[model samples]
Target chain A: MEISDTELMLLGLVAEMPRHGYELEQVIVHRAMREWTAIGFSSIYFLLGKLQKRGLIRAYTSRASNRTKAQIPGADSQISDQESEPNTKPRKVFTVSKKGMRILKNQALRSLREISAHYSSLTRGLLQWPFLSREEALAALQDRLEALRSEEDRLSGLQLDQQPLPDYENAMYDFALSQIESEYEWVKRTAEYMETKPWN
Target chain B: MEISDTELMLLGLVAEMPRHGYELEQVIVHRAMREWTAIGFSSIYFLLGKLQKRGLIRAYTSRASNRTKAQIPGADSQISDQESEPNTKPRKVFTVSKKGMRILKNQALRSLREISAHYSSLTRGLLQWPFLSREEALAALQDRLEALRSEEDRLSGLQLDQQPLPDYENAMYDFALSQIESEYEWVKRTAEYMETKPWN
Candidate 1:
């Protein structure tokens, strides 16, 4: 089964430990996973429900009225599922099944091995160079250079704020920063080259 | 006005010169534009019609029966309308309007100036490294290395096939190839680092 990036992250988190929807949101925020994946706070429950429907995960809630709620030893006490109001919904804790774990492993490996193309809009703009005058083109590239610098600063700030990261997380941050820096250098060089070349 | 990458490309192409749907498809294929922008051949007419409706472009057909058909002097002879059958539809030749030209210029500049985030799924996989075993991780990276090499070969081959390109097109191609090469180097270094370090 092809899982989305958000699904993979959520499934991996659950595989790490049984977690409720709120707990998953905390882990995502704590790790700044939003920088890499699109996981809206509102969509967490929706995604969990989808995963449960797929049999990749099983949910256990501490409500006797809910038919799908599975009974676990001391589950009601552990979760502190206080149904203070009649309208209060049952909070379910999700755990990955064996099938989910197998799929996660396979998908992770497939993701690593694949070389998906990253298309940039700038390439399209460059292809349509005739649309913009030479002055406009140079100014746009200059503006891009400034934006790249600000982006570098912003990313660095984010990394600093999320300090004492795991070795793997640190490596990911480094890779991202390296990519932006590389692009910055490319734009600078391209701008200089464009300045010297005659407009076609 | 927000325009998609494909729309921008198509609009810019029209601004360069009035072209029929079939001609636009040919230009896209001959230039290998599908690698950068998602412009399917079937969507050309749909998008053109949308642009016309939005008043960013106007279409001229050489049919007298068609009310929307415009009369460009000698357009029938120029386009060879050839409406022998009662069911035959007149081929539309789309041209960018003055307003279209202004918007296209602004959009092209904005596209150049903006630095949109390019999220990679590999980053997500790397973040969830805890799910994969050490051997599995190394093997995946190795497979990725091989894939990157093949990708490099393929991109190089494509560039070679489209020889004697314009300077701007050459620059765009170089930027793309450079990005892949940089990623390959990063992956190689990362794999080596992972080899020596203890897996978490």
Candidate 2:
């Protein structure tokens, strides 16, 4: 299937639990989906509709503003305005159909089995090192190092804003930060090498 | 200018040295360009035409089997049949025009400035942990771990095939292998976590 990364992520989320749009938005934010993709809070419903149209997910209705009553696992992390509002109308909730689970497995396997380092631009720049003077290459690596350090700082601040998260919720952030740290270390080592070695 | 990564890399190479289509293919292979991008032996001429259409590159004619006469660097790496066979037809040589150089630097800056961790499927898989039972998740992670180990083996074999390479020439393979190692470590850790933790 030609499912987008956003669509695939949404399918996985809906497969995990039948959630209303607003609740899905809360889970998306809770999982920090925005860090990797361009998925926005506003697009959740649209994606859900698309998923349902494709027969990958089915939509049902449920009473509103009562996620706690539904016994959502990460109740503390749910942050939808509608989830707390008083006496709202029933909302459309989504669950993964059998076809959805089937495709999710197929798609997830396609994703997981294909371990490509999709960070192309960095490798592009690295391969073109010969184009840069020694000083320029050094400067470029330094610039990258600065960007990574600030990115780390930005992520750490994000964690601070969501204090007392569940272990799984925290694992999502940890994976992102760990990835950043790995790149940061690699760039630092590269810069060090650039400084010592002479490339003209 | 929304140039694809192939166009950008082509721009960089042409800007570095004026080369015929055959000579460009040799340099691309020597640099292990195929490892990242899908520029095939046949497409170099097509890309050259595209570059010339945009006035980023200019074409000139040079007799075949005369690259040494052109003082080509890394002459030993040139593998194109036309470049070696005697008395072949004149071939089209590409040189980066001034406009090409300007655009190349601009595009390179754009490429280097952006950094995204493109490993989505693994993260997608992790966030959907609740969709699967503890056993299923464990099985999936184990399967991923197996794929990663085989990937490492495959990359190591690639490096071995190109023996006695220059340090700069070998950097491409090293970068690829290091990326595999990072993912291997990450998947291994994730599998271990899956093993110890129970998710319902």
Candidate 3:
């Protein structure tokens, strides 16, 4: 079964542990997962719903969570008789089913093993280089270098904030940095060429 | 005006010269543009229609093309009296209008100057590394290395085929190859770490 990258990412998170939508959002934010995945807060609930429909994940209110809730003053008063129905509840914690775990493992393995090309608008712009005047093209390339530097700084700041990262997380950050540096080098070289080379 | 990368690419091509749908497809294929953009043959006409509605491109039957068609035996007999109606013609060539050129230039410059994050599923899989056993993870990394090698070969071959490429086109290919190589290095390092590091 083909699953979208976003779906697989959500499944992997749920497989790690039972988490409420808010907790999922927190984890995503704390880890800066947005750098690598285009997931929004609203999509977390939507994806969770989809995962539940697919039998990949199921929602449940753990006894511990319920007990903690009960400890809060007047919490018991707000509890509905149909406590089993988690769909209507505002804070439904989700756990991956056995099927969900299986799918997650399969999808993760497939993703790790496969390589796919990403389309960048930079390529489109580069291919149409002749369309822009020399001055405009040079200015654009200079701006790109500045943007890349800002990106590098942002990524470095994120990496520093998450200290004591697991080896894998550290490696991920390094990988991202390396990509930026590579692009930066290419842009610098291209800019020099654009400056010195004759234009039509 | 904001245009999709695909729209900008098509507009750039039309700006290069008046071309029919088939000719655009040929140019795309010949230049291996698919590596940089996700455009399908069917979407060419769909996008063309959209560009026309936006007044960025206008279709015309150039006299040169029509004259060539008239040179064919029996072609004049097939010509309708309402020759001005290009919509009914099989080969209506599209050219970028003044507005289209202006918009294309602005969009291309913006694209060149901007940097945006692209979400990769591999990051998701890496973050959830604990989900897989050592054996499975190691095997997946091995497969990734192999996949990267194959991609490198394919890109190298494509680069070779497009000899005498413009400086910009050559740089684009180099940028792509550098990204792959960077990832290849990261994957190799990651795989080694995964192999040697103690697992929880």
Q: State which candidate has the highest DockQ.
A: 3
Q: Second chain of candidate 1: TM-score?
A: 0.84
Better of 1 and 2 by TM-score: 1
DockQ in order:
0.64, 0.26, 0.66
| Cα-based lDDT at residue B36, candidate 2 | 67
- Stretch of 10 with least lDDT, candidate 2 chain A: A74-83
lDDT score of residue A48 within candidate 3: 89
CA lDDT, candidate 3, residue A139: 96
- CA error at residue A74 for candidate 2, angstroms: 36
Off by over 4 Å in 2: A1-4, A16-31, A38-50, A59-94, A109-114, B1-3, B19-31, B38-50, B60-93, B109-114
Candidate 2 per-residue lDDT over residues B107-168, each given as its tens digit: 66655556655555676666555555566666776777777788778877877887876544
lDDT of model 1, residue B179: 82
Clashing pairs in 1: none
lDDT of every predicted structure (CA atoms):
0.83, 0.72, 0.83
DockQ score for model 3, please? Answer: 0.66
Q: Give the TM-score of candidate 1.
A: 0.86
For candidate 1, give the lDDT of residue A80: 38
What lDDT score is found at residue A41 in candidate 1? Answer: 98
Give the CA lDDT, 0 to 100, for residue B176 in model 2: 60
Considering only chain B, what TM-score does candidate 2 achieve?
Answer: 0.70
